[model samples]
Target: MSSSTPVWPAGHDRRVLAEVDSTNAEAARIAATLAGPTWILALRQTAGRGRRGRAWNDPPGNFAATLAIPSGAAPAQAALRSFVAALALADALTQATARPEAISLKWPNDVLLNGAKVAGILLETTGQGGTPGPLAIGIGVNLSHAPDPGTLEPEAKAPTSVLSATGAAIDPESFLDLLAPAFARWEATLRQHGFAPLRRAFLDRAARFGEPITARTLRETLTGTFTDIDETGALVLTTAKGPVAVQAADIFF
Candidate 1:
């Protein structure tokens, strides 16, 4: 793979791979040894994972990547990457489009364009206790196309793509160029400022307050109304059982 620099924060190591089982998997392999920030950028993948062991669909022209952060950044702080990466993805989508306000983020990790899933983020961590020894954040964006809606997989209930929705082809490198800088800025902010501002910014983008939605997670599925976002980036919802805080859940409206 030809290496053009991706705007990264200090101590970040970028590895461009031809193929991988999964970028998150690869990042976990040597994360115990690496001291600085690092990520594996993959152009293609034979196999990839999604949240809760679901399969991640990786097509060329979309961004499929993983960022490995230090192990010490975890427990309560582990999920910080979701907002950090989502903010960058939001910025990336804006750079590629004339209309940026149309691009907003769904809590935890999903990029929405016109209220459809254009991209998804999956974060995994390894460590004893609550703190993560090393964190792997994998992302998949729909660049060239979203899957056929008629014969779509069950896992892709809300799958949408930039090209399919917009009907315009976007160069991956150009999109990445826009995303990397934004990512670098947010990463720094995440390390220093924490998730409060990120959560607020994300909520400003998520204008679907009190909207009836389906909530699915690693365990069960529930229908709830979108209420608000908490400081740690939990999805706050108003359910029949009253208010609930969800650390991770699949949101479908």
Candidate 2:
């Protein structure tokens, strides 16, 4: 990493690794002793996992990183970090590709480029009870390479990459340099204006809103029309049973 890369927030510490099991796990290990925020970047991950414990195949030279921040918010509020991180990632991608119009945000925390998945965000937290401890925000972007569309998990969207979408290669380090400052700005916005403004911004760039979709929860599956997210950041699905506020689920369009 270059010394001139960009300065992070005041209490933020950054670590770059050649390889790791998972950046989120590494960030959590450090968060145990560190009081402030810590950013972890790995060149490659042997055992990266995504939402719902899905395997994240992190090839070398792609972007894989995690940010762990100590938070005082309740668990539901802390979960909102996923949206903030998603907005920041979208901003970074727009700067990298210089095509602001091609980038869009999917519900929850996925970033899409030309209707394909370019990046995904995973948010995890520590501590017990309603109030949580540190929150780990994990982000993975397909920069130089993307998996074959046929190889993606059954429910995952077709994947794309920065190189494929823009015909310009982007390395992990350079993407981090672009991402850190963007993240800091969005984090500040969230702290100041709360989720209303952030929610609006997210919806502005949201993909596939008001479309028919299926949401599969642990208990049952519901088919409904896609609707807006509520004040608490839950996905509101208008099903035959009426409006359903889904806190967590696998969605398909």
Most accurate candidate by lDDT: 2
Compute each candidate's TM-score over C-alphas: 0.87, 0.92
Model 2, residue 51: what's the lDDT?
92
- lDDT, candidate 2, 8-61, per-residue tens: 567677889999999989877888777677789999888888998988878887
Model 2 C-alpha lDDT versus the unseen true structure: 0.85
Candidate 2: minimum summed lDDT over ten consecutive residues — where? 1-10
Instruction: Compute the lDDT for candidate 1.
Output: 0.76
lDDT by residue for model 1 over 1-253, one digit each (tens)? 1134455456677777888889899988978888776767788876888777877777777777787776566467767778888998887787676568778777767888887888888888888765448888787888887756665556555678888677656766556666667888887787788777787778878847668877788898877889988886788888899988888777776
